[model samples]
Every structure is written in structure tokens, then in C-alpha cells.
Target: MFNLFKKKANEIACPMDGEVIAITEVNDPVFASKAMGDGFAVEPSNGKVFSPIVGKVTSVFPTKHAIGLLSDSGAEILVHIGINTVDLAGAGFDILVTEGDAVDLTTPLAVVDLEYLKEQEKPVTTMVIWTNSEGKEINVQLGKSNAQTVIGKLK
Candidate 1:
């Protein structure tokens, strides 16, 4: 029998160096409750944020606190930086890409001032949520990871 209709899983790389944690474990209620879809979060060890998938930039929030992407395999992802960091009004974030920019796993998304975020008393737990994975399942490996690590897969 010729096998057909088998969908390959799309890999999601880690966007930064950190310990990856389950989406439920994140400190934010909206993301913790899966209200924004399923994904993972990272307690970053540094300040650089990279693209976690091969995608096109769908949105770059005005406050520079989050970025939206449409993956090549059709997963809609939202990468949100910190808890309430948006209130800073783009003070500690440097946007590296604009909307519509094509990006791969290695592409730098933004540069955050970790020290500034700390000084502002913000929780630097970056969340990566799959905003539109209605029927798809995402499985993430929770542990230490770097930008090149394939932390999750969408199937």
C-alpha cells in the first residue's frame, strides 16, 4: 500500500538560550491557560531573541514587546517578551525586523536590554505561542536549549 496523507511535523527551533518550560508553567495567566494557543516559554540566559521558525513576519507590535510570524508550514506564532514589558513603551527592546520580512531560525528578531528589564522589575520569561494551531498538536522538549535547538514540533 502506498502511504499517503502523512503530514510531516514542522520543527520549531529555540529562539534564545535558556531553559525551556511548558506553556502551562509560564507566569502569565493568558498564556498559562492556553487562551492564546499552545507553545512553550523560555527563561532566557541572554538578551538576544532569534526567529524560531522559517517564517514571514506577520506583525511587529508597536510597543516592540511581541512579534507575530507565519511559518512556512502554516503555523502562526507569537513571541511575547516578558511580563508586562509592553508597559515600558519600547524602552528596552530593539526591533530588528519589520513586518513582512522573511526569516529563518537563525535570524535575530530583537535585542532586549536584560539589565534594563531587570531594573524595571519585569519578568523576562519569553513566551512562544502558536496563535492559530486549532487542529494541530505542538510538543516541546522542556530543558536547556539554545537558538539552534529544535525545541518543539508542530504536527
Candidate 2:
């Protein structure tokens, strides 16, 4: 029982299976909150959002935009599917999963209308964040390829 907490085995995987387009380098709280500032964003050319780690769907925003996932390893990841997409106010977005659902690494959570998003000039920003940042260290592995490629890993 004690060994469970003693083990340092918390490994958070990439939320989406896609090549990384952006990563979080800025450490400012203000910048991180903005739509186009800090945090990692992935442009999934495939238009599908996957669970980065095995966790419960904690919260699905009322707008049907962003999703909050709590990994079994205790990592909370926020997956925001597109850039300026919140402006759409739930338009052009289709959510397949709901809150409290158990999800795997390959479960499809939502789909963004890329064609419609492009018409609106919204950039997709998919962020995998360590919601509890006080004493945690996050390592993200990235690959060089198109958005279709699996490029980022978190550990």
C-alpha cells in the first residue's frame, strides 16, 4: 500500500496522437492563460482528439469545447481542440465523449471542423498541462513530422 505512493511511476502520455506543432516554454501564468501564449498546442491534421493517458473524463465544458481529463496517474490534462475556437461558442465542434466516462489512450473525445475553422482563421491549440505544478517535473518528447505523426510524449 505504501509502495504505491513511493513509486515514481507517473508517466503522462501525449493527449493526442499527432506531430507536435508547438510546446510550452514560457513560464508566465498570464501568458499560459491566453489562447496563443504558453502551453503545447498540436494541430491534428487528422481532426481527431485522443486521450493522452488512461484517465476519467472529469469535466466537459458547457460550450462543448475543452475537456478536462484526470489520468489514472493523477495528471489533469486540458485538451482544447482549436485556435480561437471558443469564439465559435460550440459551433463546428462535435463531442463524442461525456464527463465521468473512462477513457483509454486511443479514445476519441471530440472532432473539430477544420474546414470551418480555417474559414474563421482559428488556430488549433491542444495543451497537455500538469495541472498540479508545485513539485512536479514534466518531460515532453517531440518528433519531426507532419501533424499526422505521433510526435510528443510526456513523462
Candidate 3:
């Protein structure tokens, strides 16, 4: 019986490779409003949605619009791709992963259509919320200054 070669896992990766449009706060609005209109909106941007941490896909909403990830460290992160994307009913989107699946840093979970999202006047507010906020302190890592980074580490 030889069981001594397992590599210790590391923290998960950032989900999106774009600017940090928004982060989870205490007073976040229930719904995002359009910048120029009186309705909910979302802006389309092309990018691969990645897993912020190594965890299980707890729940993938029926609309394929949002995903819930439970990190190995017991931090629950909810990643909402776009505004009102649920209304699109899975249009202009491609989901590469599924629920209960273990994902790593480089795993491509989904492909987003940002152009279509912008034409619709939607607010592309990528939200990263810790459902269990009392357990861990989340700190976001910022890149140089131009690139938007949403990477968070447990401290």
C-alpha cells in the first residue's frame, strides 16, 4: 500500500479575465438597472468564465445565467455572468461545466457574448459574493492598474 504522492491542492483561480465591474457589498441592489434606460440591462463582453476557486458547482440556475460554487475552504461564491441573462433563456452563451463538478484554476466554465449584451443596454456587473461571509476574510488581488482583476484569497 503506497499512498504518499498526492499533491496538496491550491486556491482556485479568478473566474473572469476582465475588469472588476463590481464586487459583493452589503447594500448591493437586487437588480441592476440600465445606464440609459428604465429597465434591467446587461453589457456583452467576450471572455471565458473561470472558477475563482477549486470547489463544487453547487447549483446552476435553470436559466444557465448564474452559477454557485462552494470552495474547498467552505467559502460559497456566486458568480452572475450578466444582467438579465436569465431572460435570454441560455441564448448567446455556452456553459462548459456542470453542477457537482470539481473545477480548477484554468478550467473554462463558459463563453460569454459581450457584444450582444452591450447592444441590449444591460449592466455587465460581474458579482462575486461570499454567501458565507462570516467564516473567512476575502481579499481581492489587483493587477497593475489597467487590467481588472477579481482574484480573492482567504486570509
Candidate 4:
């Protein structure tokens, strides 16, 4: 008998609620061009971003503007809070997990002060990039997504 369809990978949940769009739609060239990796951008509806997979927090910038994670499945996800808000010098970003902390799909990595960023004229759109996504099957869905949404699978 033929075996039933099976899924061998875990889904990468949407790290935040937003309008999910391709990286090309991002205003930044590095992300928009997908030169780094194949991932997407989120025109964030809120400031809080959750862990997209179960993994160790590889790095949390001193500026607290971005978070890097490595999943058990070897997915490297970088969550950048805003566009050029790094100039805010971490003023509007609050990172919850530190380096080497184990996090799951629902774990909140950071909470941003969207209002503060707006006051400083910063774009609150975030990027979820798979740093090493080259040559892999890009399995993400583009559109509206949330923490509970299985946006894609990373390998």
C-alpha cells in the first residue's frame, strides 16, 4: 500500500501580525534584493515579535534592534525590528531573550515602541530573513500572517 502524505519538517510561524510581503517589497536593498537570503518582510501591525522556531538565540544586538536565532532544524532567522531605527540607539526596542537562550515558536523575542519609532520617523516594518536560505526550497506563504500562523517551513 502507498504511504500517506507526510510532513518531515516543522513550520516557521509568523513572528508577528502583519501584512506579509516578499523581501523585494521591502524598502531596503539588502532585503529587497534577497541577496542575503530568501525570506520575507512584514509591514508590522504591532511591535511585539515572537520566535519563529524552537532554537537558541544566536545573537541579540547591543542596539536591541535585531535578533538572530538558529532553529533545531538549522534555520537561521534574523528579526530586524524596524527600518533605520537603529539610529534610535535601542531607544524604542526592548529585547526579551538574550544570547544563547532557548526559544520556541511562541516565545516573545522583543517588544517595540511603535509610537516612539513613529515619533522619530522610523518605518516599523520588520524583516524575517533566513540568512542561509540559499539553494533551499523557500516554503513561505505571502500575505497576512500572525504568531499563530504557519507562514512557512525552513530547511
Question: Best candidate per lDDT, number?
Answer: 1
Q: For residue 142, give model 3's deviation from the true position in Å.
A: 3.6
Model 1 worst lDDT window (10 residues): 1-10
lDDT of 1 by residue, 18-58 (tens): 99999999988999999999999999999999988887899
lDDT of 4 by residue, 1-155 (tens): 76453222357878888898888899888778988778888888888889877778999999999999887888788888888977988898878999999888768999998899989998888888889887886678898877647777875
> Which candidate, 2 or 3, would have the higher TM-score against the true structure?
2
Model 4 residue runs over 4 Å out of place are 1-9
Cα RMSD (angstroms) for every candidate in the order listed: 5.0, 5.8, 6.9, 4.5
* lDDT (0 to 1) per candidate: 0.90, 0.62, 0.57, 0.83
lDDT of 3 by residue, 1-155 (tens): 77463212434345665444334221235633211111111122445677666677898877777778877777777777776667778765688888989966556677777676667765555555566665445555543212122354654
lDDT of 2 at 76: 72
Candidate 1's C-alpha runs over 4 A off are: 1-9
Off by over 4 Å in 3: 1-12, 21-28, 31-45, 143-150
Weakest ten-residue segment in model 3 by summed lDDT: 34-43
Superposed by TM-score, candidate 2 places the C-alpha of residue 139 at a distance from the truth, in angstroms, of 1.2
lDDT of 3 at 26: 13
Clashing pairs in 1: none
Superposed model 2: Cα runs more than 4 Å off: 1-9, 25-39, 144-155
lDDT (C-alpha) at residue 79 in model 2: 75
